[model samples]
Each structure stands twice: as C-alpha cells, then as structure tokens.
Target: MLVTALTKLLNIRIPIIQGGMQWVGLPQLAAAVSNSGGLGILTALTQPDPNALRLAIRETRKLTPKPFGVNITLLPTINPPDYEGYARAALEEGVMIFETAGNNPAHLVKSFKDHGCIVIHKCTNIRHAKSAARLGVDVLSIDGFECAGHGGEEDIGGLVLLAKAAQELDIPYIASGGIATGRGLAAALALGAAGANIGTRFLCTVESPIHQSIKDKIVASKEQDTVHIFRTLRNTARVYRNTVSEQVIALESLPGGARFDELRDLVSGQRGRRVFETGDPDYGIWSAGVALGLINDCPTCEELLRRMEREAEEAIKGMAELVQG
Candidate 1:
C-alpha cells in the first residue's frame, strides 16, 4: 500500500530494494527478497564467468518468478572482469533490470538502454546523479557517505543527499545509505525519494549468504561502530569496525601513508569473500554501513519486508495525524 514511482517502475508490491551486495547477493537471497514482493538484486560480478552469471540467473529464476534485477558495478580493479560479457549474459537471459555503480556509467547506461533494460545507476553525489539522469538511466540510486562501499569522499549524509537529488534530478531516485527501518523508508518518501535502497539491513537477513557469525556481529553493532577507510586513495569504503579495517585506517594515517598496493593483500576482494564463508570478520576488509548498528535481529526476507511495510504505513499515518491535529 505504500505505492510510489519505484513500486510502479520495478513492478513490485513495495518500494523496498535489496541493495546489490557483492558476494552476499547470491541467488538464494535475491530470490527471497523478490518473492517477498521487493526488488531483489543479484551481483552479476559475483559469478566467475559470463556463463556462470547466466547459470546464476537461471537459478534465481527457479527460486522465484517475481521481478528481480542484476547489479553490474563498474569499479576500478587491477584486473577487472569482463563487464560487457556479464551484461551480455544477463541481457541474453531476458533480464530487463540493471543496477550500475562505480566510475562513469554512461557507457553501460547507453548499452542497457539500447537493449531496453531499465538502468538504475547509483551515485554518491548530486552531480553524478544528474549526469546519470542525462545519460538516459531510468532511475538513480543516490548513496550518501553513510553507505558501506565506495561512499565517495563528499561526506554528505542521506538526508541532504536525497533532498538535493530530489531537487535537481528529473529521474526518480532511491535514498540509500544508513536506511534500515520503516521509519527510514517513511523518511525517504518524505524526502522525495521513490523508495529506500537498503544494503546493511539486508545483510542481516536469514537469506543472506554471509556467515552466521557475521550476521551476529552486525546485530550487535552500533551506529558508530563503522569507520570509513581508503579516503587517501580516493576509493573510500565504510566498513564494520574490525581489526583489519582498523589496520587499514592506521596505515592510511601514517605521515607518508600507504599506497593501495601495500594494502592490497589485506583488502583483497577474495579474502573478503572468504570471510563470508569462513565466519571471520578480520579475515579481510568487508563493506558494511553504519546501518548495521540499526539491525538487531535476523528475520526472513518475507518477514522483514512485511514488517517494514507495516511500519511505513504507521509512520505515514502518524504524520497525517500531526498535520490534521
């Protein structure tokens, strides 16, 4: 009943989006969220190859017939995978929704649009959001500095970021970063966002592929438990406060500072992936937002979305009463 542009656009029952988390956005989790009436997204790059991505898409389809999407983040890596190959695989599988992020997404936007796929580009600032809008993306997922991964160096929080994007962009945008609860969803709607793009909260869900220990850590965390690292490298990422993340911060804090190469081993994506399977938070640097502190329990995707929808309705009704009082 909390219908909005996002719900209409994505053809979902609610306007909640499970942010495409790397490694964690597996078929099981994505299918659960989609089956629960929210837009679940699979991280396309999680697959080892394009053929593997197609298999993952097929697996997700087997789990749920609801609308879901694939996230193809275009970030800088020393050995980047074939992004075009992944996109082509998804397109061939009849995927019509895509969530793109990192670096300039104009090329991917044009490609997805040409194939008639709805592209939702994630941006950390209004400038990027506007640029993506002009690039013909269908929607913008506006992430603020509170976001977990690659929050950019702007230091803007979701409040100002969402409102500014609403004021500036013609394309409807979702408010991301530090968004978790029903109150958060209601706030995003009040701030002129079509919905809330949630990452950390979804990581704590039962369907999330992360280790149970990691989910427990997120549940026990506080809002201030996260720290931003790699600002010196201009590839800032907000992660849970752990020994490894702290170590990265310390190295970056040195007088001369450490280069990305020096920190590469400790922050490698492979190590981080292993952490999800091995139940070791300090195994490597992983992406987690300040919203982890907001998570207190691990609910099934169906239960979580339903509760959020109820909470949003109550919040909206409360606001209406205040206005009519």
Candidate 2:
C-alpha cells in the first residue's frame, strides 16, 4: 500500500493514474484501473455528446463502484464538441474527479472547484504548471517531451521537468511521460511527484480497448520508435512512428512549414480511431510515448498494478541501502 498525497486525495490505494486517452479511455479500461486501486479516467469528448457521456459514466459506474474520473480536453477545434456540456454531464453523474488538458481551464475550473471536484490539469512545462496551480487546479500532471499526443513545444523530458517542478511548485503534482515500470514510479516519487500518470503503457494492457495488434506493436517497439510531429505548426504531438506520421513529418518539412489544413485529412482523429478499431497499424497515426520500450507484456490491470506496487517497494528499499550514511 504505497500512500501519498495523490492516493489520499483520490482515495485510491496506489498512486498510479491511467491517462485519459482519446478513442481509448472507455468504461472497460477506466473501471479496470479504478478497480486495481488506481485512478482511472474516461475521456469525456470521446463520447458523441453530453448525453452519451452520461451513459458512459453510468456504464463505468456499473463496472466498478470505485472512484473514477472524466477527462475533458479543451482544444481549438474548428467545430468543437460541447466542453461545458460534457463537464456538466460528468458533474450530474456525480463524478468528482476530472482530468483536464490542452488550453487553460479557467472557464470551467471555478465551476468544478465550486462543486467540490478535484481538477488534475496536464501541462508540458513548468510555466503551464504554475499557471494552472494559480488557477486553483488541485493537482498537475506534468507531461514531458516523451509523452504521447500533445507534448507542447518546449521539448523538455520528464527527468529535468519533474525535478524543476519539485523545486518550484507549491501544489502536489504527478509525473507524466515515459513512465511505465515500477522503477519509473519510484523515480517519480524520488523527484517529488505525488504519483505517476501512465498513458502509453496502459494502452498496451490486456484490458485496453485498443486492438491486440496495436498492443503487440507497442510491446515490440523501442523508445525511439516514436516520432514528434506538428512541431512546425507549434502544437507538437508525439505519435507512433508509423507510415502516416512519417508522411505528416515530410509535409511539415516543406518550405515555410505545412499548414494545419494540409495535414488535416492525414491527422484526422477519425482515421486514428480506425487504427484502434481495426488491427492495421499503418491505417493512421496513433499516440504512443517513449515508454513503449519499457512495456514488454500485456497484463491485466490488476496484475500490472500489483506488480508495480511490489517493484516500487523493492526499488525504494534497494536505493535506501545504497546511501553511504
């Protein structure tokens, strides 16, 4: 039973958190993680609308009575889904935990805190973390350059970012990006994080909603198998090194950089969703972190969580013995 501020705050036995991945964070995976004593998150916008989100929340509740969160990512889409509607739906469904990412959550933070909800905002750098802290976000999930999806443009990895966060931040934060194993969990604690947020590793779990082939590819991939795309557009995203992602990189390398309109068809979220639905890896670009190299097998959520707990304890104990004092 590894206890920390995150565990106490979320009322979970373990400090690990399952990242709210789009097209992946569903009832099955979220409930699995929560049942394993870690915080699980359902992607709110993954549902078609607020009504659908309510149903998904209800479905997750049926799977596990344990606490779970809803992830509402705020991005600048041409025709965005109803963000407030999703939040309200989650609140109406009695979900008190939220994981917000992309854009400042100023518009919704007050309402969430006022309703006694704990908001965990994901940030790529210290500047964004501090800004979110000032906005009254309960906790921060600090992402590194090795993270999947949008990793921001700073390109700072978790090692230096987590250490810098420990020195400067006043609020409790969890380390995100490139963390898959128990040793990674222990390292996050050593760096002053309340816990760790895992995305890519969780995606490769037995219970993950993705296709088996996708999981297999992740298991076989190395740390360098991921490519950082959209850097020329300023909204950098780390994705699996697939044919489509490589094509996007090529287009971005064109003179004056590629515009969002040119890459829109290739990077469409629907296309990426198909990759998960089907077993075709080259169908579209999918988000994957450097932690893919650390994942060797697809175990059940329960098996993974228990193993991580044991390994983290062993790692901490072994490190204590190394001290000369």
Candidate 3:
C-alpha cells in the first residue's frame, strides 16, 4: 500500500525495486520481481546487441504482464560501451522505466521522456538528486555509502542522502544501499524515503539466474566478507573478498603504480561473463552489498517479498508499541 510516484509511474503494486546487476538482472530475474509486485530492472549492458535485448524483453513479457525497467549506466568511458544505443534499445523494446547511473542524465531524461519512458536516475548526493529532479526524472534512487556500486564522492549514507533528497526534490525517492530486511524497509520510510530499492537481497533469490554456488556464498557471507574497489576513480564497487577481487585490490595498491590498462585484463567483461555463467568464484567479479550477511536463504521472489513485508510491518509495529509503552 506504500505507493509512490515510481510505483504509479511503473504501475507496480509495491514501491520496492530490484536493482540491475550485470549478469544477474536478466529478463527472467526482472520478470520474477515484476510478477512478485516489485519493479524489476534489466541490465542493458549484459545484452550483446539491441536484438538480444529486444528478445529478452519479449521473453519477459511471456513470463509476466507486470511492469519492469531497463538499466543503462553512464560509464567513465574507459571502455567503448555504447550507452546511447542501450537507451535506444530499451525504448525500442517498449521499456517503461529507464534507469541511469553515473552521469548527469539530462539527455537521457529528454530522450526517454520523448519516447514516453519513466526516467529514474540513481543519485548518491543531494545535489545530484536535485539535478535529476530538475531534469524531470520521475523518480530518484538515493544511493548511500552502503550501496554496492559506486556510491559517489559524497559518501552520504542512506539516511542523510534521503533527507537531503526529500528536502530539495519534489519527486519521490527510493533509498538504496544497506537495505536488506523488512526492518531496513521501515528504516527507509523513516528516513524520508517512500520505498526501497534492493540489490543484494534480490540477487540471492531463487528466481535469480546466478549459479547456486554464488547464492550460497552470499547467503553464508558476513558483512566483513565484502570490500570496495575503484574508489580512486569515484567508481567504487563493493564486491566479495574472493581470490580475484583480492588480487585486483593488491595490484591497485602496488607502489610503483602500474598503468590502468595493465589491470584492464583483470576487469575483463569476458572474464566476468565466464565466471558468472559457470559457478567459478575463483576468477569472477561478484559485486554485492554488505547486506550479504543478512541474507540466509534462496526463497522465491514471492516468498521473499512476503517475508520482507511481514518483517518490515512487524518491526514498525513493534516500534510503535515501544513508543506506546
């Protein structure tokens, strides 16, 4: 019942959002979220071509009539990923929600707006959220320091980040980062967020396409098991402390600084694809949030949502009872 502008814009039953993970957030995962009453977003960069994206979209429609979205990140241009084409592909696929991170997104807002897509820009700072609101995005995803990928230079936590966004922006915002359970959902609402957008929790769901070994790791991992990378580039991503991630961090910290391209082989998309596709954790990039400690099982999307709603509601009620006492 906690409907926001985003829920209305995307016609989803719940204000919750499932983030777009590179290898994990495909049509199957996205549709599962949508059908389970949350807004599921497809990671457009995962698709090799526009045709593949279109096919994926079609496949999702077959699974669920509920709404879903497409995520197109604005990268730092170290690689030659065609961002605009991804946006265009989403539009051609009749995407309802167009989410962009890592850029100003003014042009994306205009283009997607013209094509009748609801733009939800991910922001890590109040100024960024204000800018996105001014650009006419329908919703803002307020990412905090606890977020999995690139929490930005500000380092605002979800609480302060949402307060700032709520103070300045007219559009509704979803609190990202550090949110894992129903109690976290209640906390987000208390922090001035209309809803929550979760990544790590959804990643471990049964409907998610990632390998069981990966899900098991997330379920068993503790908060300390995660670490950050690329913080120097303001593109910091939180990933599990696996062998490959450890090596990457070690190489980055070396004194006589090596070239960025030297480690370029470390961050290869091909390497990531192979690892995520196969169950090979030794050589893969498993980006996740510290909330991995909180998740303990791989439930279906419906079961997860039900459990979250129950836990969140009960937590809020308990708090209310405490006040009454």
Tens digits of per-residue lDDT, candidate 3, 1-325, equal 5556656767777778998778877988999998988888888888887678878888988998988888888777756577777777778777878788887678778999898778888988888788888888888889898888677766667777777776787878889998888889888887778788899899888898988877887888888888877655446778778888887788778886445677678877687777767878767666778788789899999999878878877887887887752
The better candidate by lDDT, 1 or 3, is 1
Candidate 2 runs further than 4 Å off: none
| lDDT tens digits by residue: candidate 2, 1-325 | 6899999999999999999999999999999999998999999988999999999999999999999999999997788789999999999999999999998899889899999999999999999999999999999999988888899888898999999999999999999999899999999999999999999989988889999999988889999999989898888898999899999999999889899999999998899999999989999989999998899999999999999999999999999999985
Give each model a TM-score: 0.98, 0.98, 0.94
Question: Comparing candidate 2 with candidate 3, which one achieves the higher TM-score?
Answer: 2
Cα RMSDs of all predictions? Answer: 1.0, 0.8, 1.8
Candidate 1: residue 302 Cα off by (Å):
0.4
Q: Give the TM-score comparing model 2 with the true structure, all chains together.
A: 0.98
**Which pairs in model 2 have colliding backbones?**
none
Total clashing pairs for each candidate: 0, 0, 0
Residue 88 deviation, candidate 3, in Å? 2.5
Off by over 4 Å in 3: 322-325
Return the candidate ranking by TM-score, descending. Answer: 2, 1, 3
Looking at model 1, residue 195 earns an lDDT score of: 92
Reference-based lDDT, each prediction: 0.90, 0.93, 0.81
